[model samples]
Target: MQELHDAPLAPLTTFRLGGPATRLVTATTDAEVVEAVRAADESGTPLLVIGGGSNLVIGDRGFEGTALRIATTGFHLDGTRLELAAGENWSDAVARSVEAGLAGIECLAGIPGSAGATPIQNVGAYGQEVCDTITEVVAYDRTTGETVTLTAAECAFRYRNSTFKDQPDRYVVLRVRFALEDAGGLSAPIKYPETARALGVEAGDRVPAARARETVLRLRAGKGMVLDPADHDTWSAGSFFHNPILSDEAYAAFLARVRDRLGAGTAPPAYPAGEGRTKTSAAWLIDKAGFTKGYGTGPARISTKHTLALTNRGQATTEDLLALAREVVAGVHAAFGVTLVNEPVTVGVSI
Candidate 1:
């Protein structure tokens, strides 16, 4: 374990907009992670678990507790079953699965963060969610003070949320196990229309796993979703807002509002989320609300390449980013009745 006092946290996150942590502990093994957590709990200190730092937004005030960075590494593959330590890089793990001819997670390529963090957010991209392949999550149950293994069903996986997320302080994920498909080196059936169009194949068609992974990476890069230090647009927490899933009544009202704002012929992106629920694109809402690409004059602005991402243009404070986000949210709500919700987890701040 490596420990530092009053460590700057901005450099750890993709947005690069936070103050310092009172104490930072980098744990390279599951044992160390558990030990660190126990120590913090015993001392009654608040604990913050950090992984790849892709989906985090720490405030300028920073965390007054111990920020534990999970850096453990382990990737064990037994036939089609895979087990990864909490600290394994997510995007790299996807590539490795593709190289090994696994078919389940190819569509999640280029997503940032650690493998352990995937279950917390039920991370998904291009129609594939971690819950689709994840069989179990091994975590330290802080409440019980024992390590426990929870099955997929027990995780209560939902759209971009899970049991771990709902009860953030209850469990410390140590490892994740997945059951991937061995589809003869072919990718899983393409589900997202955008990905299918990019691959020049019809939806439901199966291509080479590597080809699917590469195609998704290319698409992500084009939208500034992939990490590129040279590109300021990539300095963002992927999508700034979650696609709002509204009830039938809410959707009807939203549609009426959309027609009122953008003419009766205008149709915003809508997809069936579940029974009587519909999911609409947050990107479309933001764009239609007049916050187009590169939508701010301050250090924080929407990505020039994508409407969904809010980027930090080289120099930005947490307040600057939040201000831009609030503006986008209020603008979208004024244009349409639907309110936008942030996708990234905020630390010591509310948006």
Candidate 2:
């Protein structure tokens, strides 16, 4: 375990906008992770867990407690079953699975963050979610003070959320186990239309796993979703807002508002989320609301390549980012009745 006092956390996150942490602890093993958490809990100090820091938004005021960075390394692959330590890089894991001819997570390529973090938000992109292949999550239950394994069903995975995310302070993820498909080096049936079009295949067609992964990476790079240090556009917690899911009545009203404002022919991207619920694209809403790509004049602005992302243009503070996010959210809500919710987990701040 490596410990530091008053450590700067801006460099740890993709946004590079946060202030320092009162104390920072980097744990390189599962045991160290547990130990660090236990010590903080025992001392009654507020505990902040960090992984790849890709989906985090820490305020300029900083955290008043210990910020524990999970850095453990373990990638165990046996046959089609894979177990990864909490700290394993997520995008690299997807690439490795593709290299090994696994079929499940190819479409999730280019997503940043740690493997442990995937289960928390039920992280999904293109068409694949971790919940689709995740068999179990091994976590230290802070409430019980014991390590326990939770099955996939027990994780209660939902769109962009899970049990761990709902009960953020109750568990510390240690390892994640996945059951990948051995599809003769072919990818899973493509589900996202954009991905399918890019691959020159129908929606249900399967391409080579490597090809699927590479194509997704290319698509992400084009949208500035892939990490690029020199490019300020990639300095964002990919997709700042979750696509709003609306009830039948809410969807009806939203559609009416859309047609009223943009024109009767204008149609916002809508997909069936569940029974009587519909999910609409956040990007479409922001763009139609007049917050187009590269929307801000300040240091914090929307990505030039993607309307969904709100980025730090090399010289932004957490407050600057939040201010821009609030403006976008308010603008979207005023234009349409739907409210936009942030996707990233905010520390010591509210959007």
Candidate 3:
């Protein structure tokens, strides 16, 4: 275990914008992690658990508590079953699955963050979500102070949310287990239309596992979802807003508002979220609401490559980023009667 006092946190996040923590502890093993957490708890200190720092927005004022960074590494594969430590880099793990000829997780290839964070957010991309393959999650329950394993259903996985997210302080993820498919070294049937078109295959067609991973990586790079330090557009938490899923009545009102703002001929992209629910594109909403790609002129702005991403262009404060985010949310709500919600977890800040 490594410990630092008054540690700067900006470098830990993809956006590179937060302030500092009163104390930061980097744990290389599950034991160290639990010990550190217990110590903080015994002292009655606020605790913040960070994995990849991909989905976080810390305030300029910093955290006045213990920030425990899980840095342990473990990757064990038994046939089609895979277990990863909380600290394993998620994107790299996806690539490894492809190399091992596993079918699941191939579509989640370029997402940045740690494996532990995936279950917390039920991370999904290209029509594949972690919840689809996750069999169990082993976590240290702070409430009971014991290591407990929760099955997928018990996690209560929903669109980009789970029990871990609902009770953020109650559990610290230690490891994640997934059951992937062999599929004769072929990828799972392509579900996302964009990936199908990019691969020159129809939806539901199976391609080489490696090819599918590479195709998703290419698509992600184009949208600045893949990290590239030289590019300001990639300096963002992949997608800033969650695609709003509205009830039947809400969707009807939103559609009416869309027609009023855009025109009778215009239609906002919509997809079935669940029974009586419709999921509309956040990117489309931002663009139609008059916030085009690369929307802001400030240090914080919309990513030039993707409308869904809010970025920090070299020099930006947490406040600057939040300001742009608030602007987009307010404008979209005013124009289309749909309020956008941020996907990243915020500390000492609200938008």
**Deviating ranges (above 4 Å) for candidate 1:** none
How well is each residue in 103-211 modelled by candidate 3, as lDDT tens digits? 9899999899899999999999997999999999999999999999999999999999999999998999999999999998999999999999999999999999999
**Poorest 10 consecutive residues by lDDT, candidate 2:** 10-19
Residues 1-351, model 2: lDDT tens digits: 999999999899999978899999999999999999999999999999999999999999889999999999888999999999999999999999899999999999999999999999999999999999999999999999999999999999999999999999999999999999999999999999999999999999999999999999999999999999999999999999999999999999999999999899988999999999999999999999999999899999999999999999988999999999999999999999989999999999999
- Candidate 3 has its poorest 10 consecutive residues by lDDT at 259-268
* Candidate 3 segments exceeding 4 Å error: none
Pairs of residues clashing in candidate 3: none
List per-prediction Cα lDDT, in the order shown: 0.95, 0.95, 0.95
- Model 1 root-mean-square deviation: 0.6
RMSD per candidate (Å) reads 0.6, 0.6, 0.6
Q: In candidate 2, which residue ranges exceed 4 Å CA deviation? A: none
The Cα error of candidate 2 at residue 306, in Å, is 0.4
What's the residue-level lDDT of 285 in candidate 2? 96
